[model samples]
Target: MRFLPRIVTFFLLLPSYAWTQTMHNKRYNVLLICVDDLMPELGCYGNSIVKSPYIDSLAARSAVFTKHYVTVPTCGASRYSLLRSTLPRTKAALGNEAAKILSDPETAIGNEPETFIEQYRRNGYHTVGIGKISHSPDGYRYPYAGPKSDQRELPRSWDEVSFNPGKWGHGWNAFFAYADGESRITMQGEVPPYEAADVPDEGYPDGLTAALAVDKLKMLARQEKPFFMGVGFFKPHLPFNAPQQYWDLYDAGHLPLTAVPNIPANINLASLHNSAEFNQYRLGEESAALDQPLSDGYARKLIHGYYACISYVDAQVGKVLQALEETGLADRTVVVLWSDHGWHLGDYRVWGKHTLFDRALRSVLMIKTPAMSRCKVVNRITSTIDIGPTLLELCDLPPLSQADGRSLIPLLNDVQDKAWADVAYSYYNHGISMVTPQFRLTRYFRKEQPVIELYDHATDPLETRNIAERSPDIIRQLTPLWERGNTGVYAK
Candidate 1:
């Protein structure tokens, strides 16, 4: 090598390393907010009916992702994919039992694939998980009808994982709880799927969770080390229970039902299912059928309940954001709000998220970092799994070598980037969906009555028409992209 001055040689040899060091020294705090079963029904997503003012405000300060998706449509698998920064590597990762399956020491990759939160904790950041930061709603193990287990969902990730079930006592109980400490478990099938109780925010479990998170923020603010605080909110998911005030924000009669409530034309009806998840509440007025539309009155009521829960969760998020500002941590923190997966409100005649439909796969994702000032919408395709690598890169951490997602920092820096991935992938059991910029292609790995459905997003944004039979060239173009998503159990 040619001889040069010490300073000049050092700069020439380590420009990228020096930048990473400087960024690492900044010690930016990370606020990861995970909302459960939230659809893109916010005011920012151009739905004027939903009263999501706080999240909308956050969107104004953040790079809003209009085409973001998850790797799985169901909650546990979707969250598992997001946290692990990988595609579902096994069949168990595709179910609600993902915590037990993916975190088990015997079968998990390297005795549980290292979580991004665990990486943050290892990097000397104090990691805190408030509610359902993992597969479980309260970050603890629980049977569907029993008390909670002593086992933590991600045993080695958090410096502190705390939740206040209040009078509901445990996680699953609080999951279907209402105001005044009453949960569905104690109500004996008498309680309805939705409730608008006349009480304060603390009347519901999410309200209590918000209060706990605020207190945690205050505690984290006093700490000397940078923190990775994951605040998970359980709302708008099921049993759409909120304080009556949030319900008062909406007019039931004015709220519109889904325009495309029937099965898509020429698509397999097997792709859609009855609203079994919604009907499980035991007191629902009517069970959603694959053949029949929900009653107009019941549909309005469901919409009202859904919006109420969204507003309620929005208020809780507002409190946390307010705390961030008050603690003087806003400037030093990177705030990201994401939903596990999207839910359906009578779309394709489905009331819950189970299908490989775009309504279930596409979700809400927004990231606000200290480096970005002007808010923009990133229309480029992205996935929730990309979140892990993005956070790692932003914090100057080492790359996750096994991660399936690419860092979205490029899009964050320039929202109009054209060289981004043109497709997003989502999976449900045996079915796989690939969402390209202008189309959605789904394939079910079935030996009997195999299904390959395609929807052209250019003209049918609602995915009401399956054009696979009419468009052979498009199918040929997108088939490779669809097959590339066949990881885990679906892989050949």
Candidate 2:
């Protein structure tokens, strides 16, 4: 009314429109929690021995994916696949693709003009990451809008805390410094005398991770802006350390035996390049004597240690969930819990991850959305790649053009009759594994030589027998499916 200048009037109208746009584009906050080298040992997954109270409760509120599988078994490869929503084989073929895509200003993975995090950021959400969200060390490459720091090491990225004492590297009571051909194990921390409170599960790094996550969540909730926080826990991996109390929970004598008596003679030497990594954890005569056969007692002890570690990690998970609820972000936030890949605790006579075995490839995927009516469990074969697209959908962001995975919103919403494919594909250095609802087929191709392994999971859930040599017709039928690299025809 006061005859304001035209430019001034335009500027005056801009703020209201911007405010409206911000409100209109508000996206759901995401809390992505990842664990390293964890298997499906939680109570929700039907593991009676492992005590995962927090995850079990979280599963009660979320849609638990019973048949979720990682695209790769290794840490670096699996993390890359999940973050990019690309098949592991595709990523492997495009070696260094992750670095290339992230560095490209024009087409960053998950930062394209319409990428999920970019869209959320544009809509005024704060994106922050903690711990090992990226394949790179020190949380190097993520869309973190805030401080980034490696709490574990120097040359920190953004912001970091100090490492928790007595809880590093799987919480092993003994510390080993790798030097020359010989390794020495010395007691780094005191194992409390057989007391009720001195369990190994209580002393693991996962507990530290959980405490840090809880603290971070509390701090973040004070800010007005909604946030996407990634909290990663490193545990149940190696060094097999837990509180002595956890060790006391199970008698080594009563622990389960290894599935195999010894390493299979049929496994080629080339397939065992990283054998030392697994060998480092073997106990008793095999570990002490190096080349000697593993004793039954030592194998049982290793298994017992592994179960204790899982329970320890599970307790840490409970702490984070409690923090989320306490901070009042539980209702508005979308919570996604995943493991990079499964681990092998004496399955197939292999002691670590890196193979295409089901014990190493299958992981846990649990998604809790604010929109879901109740807890549901989907047993369909799903790949880790689907996680990226699912997060995009949850944030109300358009799927990235380069994303090979389809959104799993339909599945979460109880649309069971929707058509989908049976096969979920994974890959390693030179091996390819294709898993269907009832079968797992692995094909190894190296130097033009072909080797095949197949397991009917329905009949042999432990994968103790290989039926590939006996079933040529089944192999022929499934080989093409693996070659196609498509789960099934779905809308892009």
Candidate 3:
């Protein structure tokens, strides 16, 4: 047998995905920042243009997962899989309403504490969730344009779950709110796709969420219990709106456009869309379609709005990080910054996240622990489901049985870990896509011409073409590994 050299590792490994290392006797707290519809477009992710200074600074000291993929691409389903430490098994589980099951009367019975937050809360951690941590902006069950309900999205997860709707009157309204407190849901096709308001950061709901997070940190800092805090910021999602100052940070005329703005080769149109979600903004400059690309001017303008939203949210994150330092809780807390999923800035002529392509499935993830070695990029593939277990291990809490997620604590010890299984799974558009370091194989459960699509990342990093038709041997070898991800949840 081949031999390898001895190596050092974290001393507190125990059980499956459990770690007990600690900083003195103090309990470790967590501050989770959930950013909506964000890709790895930050400065640290090698996007030379998108202004994400705060997140970049955090990435400088954190274990950044460059290949982190979401179980689902949409905001709600992705977050549902994230909080539950599971993958999508049902069609509903792949939708925005997936979190409502946590409070379901009949089905939620016999659950293992509903969500990871509930797991923490049950174990004496003071769990606080604000903004859109689990689907709903305010953690409540309500229609997009209906009256607010007392029902909680994850009924037993957090000790306190909340969000301020500001002038929007309700959480759903705030989610789609404009600068004038009107939402696209209520106004119905009247709003544009983007906005740049000449107002302060507080003019946006995300700004208010940040201020609330800062306040909560200040309050939680004075407490004695170990805390689990989720701070969600809604920006760079839709109807991209931010303060004028953040908007001024970019020049639309000089913004970069998607290199491959047209559709990919040989994939079915069923795998793509006519940008129906982006079309909801009826007053936008131009509509995005699979046939042709958006005008260069309009595309640049949309990119400008997205970049501004990112910078605006980045400022809010900076505020919360500063609050942690000011409250003297920075040394005892683990900060995990993640985006629910990625977005298409006209990538492959798509403007949304409902597809199962790499552009939609891959997102940004960074975990910053007090004892972690200075900023390192873990090139290993990781899944969103792994986050919950990683948080448990990082905070020295007991491990829970997850659907497929494993502990990432070991990766912190060695970024180039050969023992790591470099594969991540995602489900959406009635399909399952698996991403490895060298390949991406997608199997769609539909009657499309090309049910199997494969992209070799080693040579085609841009995923320009599908080579599955020609690479029979590679596909045959990879199929069994990809099949492991099905797990009966995506069964018909």
Best by lDDT: 3
Instruction: Please give the RMSD to the true structure for each candidate, in Å.
Output: 8.8, 13.4, 5.6
lDDT of 1: 0.82
Clashes of each: 0, 15, 1
The digit string of per-residue lDDT tens for model 3 on 376-433 reads: 6677889999999988876667777754688887787766667889998888877888
Candidate 1 residue 208 Cα shift, in angstroms, is 0.8
The sequence of per-residue lDDT tens digits that candidate 1 reaches over residues 66-136 is: 88988888888888888888887678889988877545768555733368888888888999999988878
Higher-lDDT candidate of 1 and 3: 3
Model 2 agreement with the true structure over 249-355: per-residue lDDT tens digits:
67777665645434333344343234455554444235422233346666666777677666666777778888888989776788899998887665545567777
Tell me model 2's lDDT, rounded to 2 decimals.
Answer: 0.61
| Local lDDT at 464 for model 1 | 88
Off by over 4 Å in 1: 1-24, 111-113, 447-450
Ranking by lDDT: 3, 1, 2
Clashes of 2: 15
TM-score, one value per model: 0.93, 0.76, 0.95
Model 3 / residue 256 / CA error / Å = 0.9
